[model samples]
Target: MIALIGAAVAPGIAILSYFYLRDSLEPEPISMVIRSFIFGMLLVVPIMVLQYIMQNEWNWRDGIVAEVFQSAVVEEFFKWMVIYFTVYKHLEFDEPYDGIVYAVAVSLGFATLENLFYLIINGTNIAIWRAFLPVSSHALFAVWMGYYLGRAKFSKDAKHERLFLWMSITLPIGLHALYNLIFLAVQNWLVVIVPFMLILWWQGLKKVQRAHDFGSKNLSSRPQ
Candidate 1:
């Protein structure tokens, strides 16, 4: 029970951070940001259901190996698809930061739902840690994915645009897979997991700042 509660904290902070950051960006109206968050949250229903089905159907003898690949494919694919199909065309996605905001929102939403389920089944003790770290890590992964995506969407340089597009999709999926692999390998090392998650969050913050800085510069350089 305690663990579950702990786990929930991470996602909560990440979600809140995403909204706060979105508010800081001066590109779109508050309503648009809120709408995106809601949309991102809504996407979790289908993703979770699909993942559940896949996991049950594709059960394997080795838990670690099975979870690492399956979890990555199920989570990353759905989150990316939601951002691409729903939020990408929205007017709110006017700036590069918008991509990161939307992506983080979606990722956090998925984490929230997943966390809730794990907490309920495991109890509050387990929930606590999950709330703080895994959830946040998921958000960080989304931020990394979103940064590149935002760059691709807003970039005028053709080469940069393509590079960003690929990174946007690949980076998050890769990181997510790596995280899963780590969990599979080190299921009991709470100390190590904590530091690793912190590193992921730190990296995410850097990515967000970089995207924001780049966007600001581009916006300023545009002709009046």
Candidate 2:
């Protein structure tokens, strides 16, 4: 049981640590990072409730649209909410990279708790699979959002800021929906999934490096 819990948690923590390290400038307050994480953990309830209603009551669970919306749109939206309310306007959010730092912290929190529940019910037999697929995928999706989020924060122009913010939310939803769709379309076709994850990892790593390289001043690298 201890091992199972550890196995469930390792991926999120490891990824969180990696992102934390990428904060090249001053790090944000640990308390705030932790606060972001706890808030994210708490969001699981509302997200689950919303998804449950959509799946059970609304009967959207029968189609691929449901799979995409419920998994990608719903989860990402709540995570975005957690950020917008909790850390978005906080004074500590002073730099571009801070977005990724806080974003990953909250995301790992969500991923860690989500993983615990899944591993608890399904047992550790699938632990490896969960880590590679769900846990890591959550981190990547957060990166997708965080990259744009970071840009939006330091964006000088109001229109650029709004565009970046919009991309932060929408891009992740699209990537996440694609991730879910790949799994939904073909069971046990990890071959297809592995390449997709690899491509995402390449893109995400660049984002990570960009965040790492961000100077004390905000760089104006808007994505096209």
Candidate 3:
């Protein structure tokens, strides 16, 4: 029971840290952030339920194509859509980095629930592995998605704007699919995926820094 609680709660805390860090730069009201987190989790529940059904019906042995399309594709699509339609337009999304912030929130929300389910069924050891790697990977995936979303939000060029928006969805989905494939092919190779996750963390940090710099510049230029 202690292990189960840790497995369920730890990822949510880790993902919440990203928001707390971002809040340091451009502080959102705690109430708003809490609302966003809850909403994000609420929005993804249907997708999770659907995935559960599909997994039982088709199973991974069906083939790579089926697994990718039915599992990874379906899950990522719904998560991304929730961010794009619901969170993207929120007033709190005032800067480019806001994209990354909110995207990570939604992704982590989905991941937290998914992790809890897996941990409950599989047990503690599997939960430990998932807590470190897959949970972090989902956070990284959101980082990139938010990076492109920031670009799309801030870009002046119409073509570039559209490109960034599309890339925001596609790139994360591709990374997510690849991550799933790697785990599917050789579960032992998760150690190798750690470096890729590190790269993603670096990328997310860069985007956040860029957004901070941009906001700083704008503030400095404003007449008092």
Best candidate per lDDT, number?
2
Instruction: Please provide TM-scores, in order, for all candidate models, with all chains considered together.
Output: 0.83, 0.93, 0.84
lDDT of model 3 at position 213: 78
List residue ranges in candidate 1 displaced over 4 A. Answer: 1-14
Of models 1 and 3, which has the larger TM-score? 3
- Model 2 lDDT tens row, 19-82: 8877767778888888888877888878889888998898886668786898899989889878
Candidate closer to the true structure by lDDT (higher is better), 1 or 3: 3
Off by over 4 Å in 3: 52-61, 217-224
Q: Give per-residue CA lDDT, model 1, range 63-145, as digits (tens).
A: 66456555776678778888888777776677788788778777776677677777778776666567666777778888887
TM-score of 3: 0.84
TM-score of 2: 0.93
The per-model lDDT (C-alpha) reads 0.73, 0.85, 0.74
Segments in model 2 whose C-alpha atoms lie over 4 Å from true places: 216-224
